[model samples]
Target: MSTVVNQTTPHRSGSVAVIGRPNVGKSTLTNALVGAKISIVSNRPQTTRHRLLGIATFAAGKDAPAGQIALVDTPGLHRQQGKFSASAMSKVMNRAARGALEGVDAAMLVIEAGRWDDEDTLAYNVLSDAGIPVLLIVNKIDRLRDKSALLPFLAQVSQGRTFAGVHPVSALKRNGLDALVKELLMLLPEAPPMFGEDEITDRSERFLAGELVREQLMRQLGAELPYATTVEIERFAEDTSLKQGELLRIGAVIWVERESQKAIVIGKGGARLKEIGSKSRLQMERLFGRKVFLETWVRVREGWSDDETALKAFGYE
Candidate 1:
C-alpha cells in the first residue's frame, strides 16, 4: 500500500501582542483565547521568557469577525539594565517584546486594576514606541468589589493617549472576557482560518510540557527558584502498554544558575525535587491524558540567560 500525505492551507491571520508587566494575566489571556494552556501562567513576575503564539480559530462564533485571531503572549516589560540586575536575562525579554510588536495588526496592553505603577507606564511606552494600535486591557477587575473604582484609572489612562478601546476584564475570573473578545474580533483583520478546525494552539506538546513544569516550579519554589531555573525536555517517548494499556515516559533536565540554588530546589533529602516532580507529572498527565512518568534533574549553567548558544538551544532565537 502507498502512503498518503495531507496538506493544510495556512490561513492568513493577523497577530496581536499581549504586553504587560509581570503577573498581570497576559499568559492567562493567551491560554483563554487558545482554549488550552498555550502559555504557562503563574503568580511570579516575568514568568514568560519567550514570545508564544496561540491560534484562535473562529469559523463562526458570536464574536467571530471575518475569521480567526492569533494571540501572541510576550514577556513582561521592566527595567533590567541596572544594579538590580537581570538585564542579561532581559535580552530574552526584549526579544519577546520585539517579536510581538513587529508585524502585528493590533496589540493588547494588560494591566492590574488595583495597582498601576511605573512598570505599567513603561509597558505602554514600549508599545507606543512600536507604532502599533493597542487595546487597553484592565485585567483583574474581579479583585475590586466596587468595580467603579476602576473608572478613575481607566479615564486617566485613556486621557493620556488614544487607545482602540478600554476594556475592564478579569482573565482569572473569566469575567468580561466576552466583551474583550468581541472588541478583539472587531479590531482583527478580516482573514481566513489560520489553522485546522481542531487546532487550538501553535506550541508543541513538548514545549507546553516544559512550560507546565516551569510554572509548577515557580508555584512551589516561589519567585527565587523559578527565575533561576530553566527546563529542557531531553527525551520524550510514547509507548503503548505491554497489554491493552497506554502511558508515556517523559525525561527532562531542569537547569539552574548555581549549585546552591540546586540544593534549595532539591531540598533536604530531595523532598522539594520530589514534590516538584509529583505536581508536574499530574499536570502533564492531565494535559496528555495518559500515564506520564516524568524525571527531573538539576544542572548548573553560569549566565545561561546571556549565553547566545544557550539561548539558541532553548529556542529563544
Candidate 2:
C-alpha cells in the first residue's frame, strides 16, 4: 500500500528541509535539485553550517501546476561537548544546526547508503518530535557494491514512522533524481511559483562566489584544511573598460583558523594560494559568464568556528 499524503489537490508548493547526519551528501543533493551550485560540497563532515536554499521549479506535474518548492539544506546535527562561545555568529550556524525541522512543511531524512547508526536515530527522533512529514533519502548508493544491503536498513528507519516515500539516490552521479523530484512535487501543495522560473536559489551572487572559492579550496586541500577555512568576496565588478565584452574583477579573502593553517593555505612562497585563486577564478567565469580576474588574500582568524562574532562575519550566524 502507498503512504498517505496530506495534499491531494494538484499544484502544491512549500518548503522542505533536508536534514541528515554529517557527510551524508545534503549539500550535493541540494545542488542537484536546483540544477545549480547553490551549496558547497566537501568530503569533510560538518562542512555545511548554514541553511542553504535551493529553489526547485515544477511545471505541469501529475498533481500540481507549475510552481517552485524551496529546499532548505540544513546543517548536520551533532552532539557537541566543551564550552561554546555565545555571541552573534554562534547564533546563526548554530541556530541552523539545532533547528533543522523548524518552519519546514516536510523533511527529507538523508542517510548514508551503507552506514546507519545512533546519530540517524537521534535525527529522526528530533524530526518526529517536530511533526513534519519525512521522506527517507538513501544517498551515496553508488558507493555501495551490494545494493541489497540497504533494504533492511531502510525498513528499520521507516518502522513506526509516517514516511511520504523512500528513494535511493546518488547525488554525485545524478542518479534517481528525476523520480525523487517527481515524488517531491506530488507531495507539495499546488500554488503559483513563489520565485521566478529563472531563479535558481535565494542566495546572493557575492555569497555564492565566496562559496565557490571555498569549494575549490575544500576540493584541493582535502579533509584536513576544508574544515578550517572560510571565504568572503570583498568586491565583484565588471570592468568598465570592456563595455561590449564580458570581463569581471573579483577580490576575496580566505580566512584560516590559525597562522600555521594560513601558511599552509598560502603554500611555499604563495604557490598554493595562486593555484587556489586560479581555479576559483575559472569557476567564477563559468558562473558569471565572463572573464574573471580574481585576487585572494589569506588571513588568520583564531577560533572563528567557535567564536560567535567571527562566525557572524563569515555568515555562519
Q: Write the per-residue lDDT of candidate 2 for residues 200-295, one digit (tens) a residue.
A: 888887888898888878887865675678888889887889875577788999998898998889999899999989888887777767788899
Report each candidate's C-alpha RMSD, comma-separated, in the order given: 5.8, 4.3
Off by over 4 Å in 2: 1-9, 61-65, 82-94
lDDT of 1 by residue, 133-234 (tens): 899998888888876778887877788687888888878777777677767777766566667757767778888788888887888886566567888998
What's each prediction's TM-score?
A: 0.89, 0.89
User: What TM-score would candidate 1 get against the native?
Assistant: 0.89
Assess the local accuracy of residue 131 in candidate 2 as a C-alpha lDDT between 0 and 100: 80
> What overall lDDT goes with each candidate model?
0.77, 0.78
> What lDDT does candidate 1 reach at residue 216?
79
For model 1, the stretches where C-alpha displacement exceeds 4 angstroms are 1-13, 59-66, 83-86, 240-245
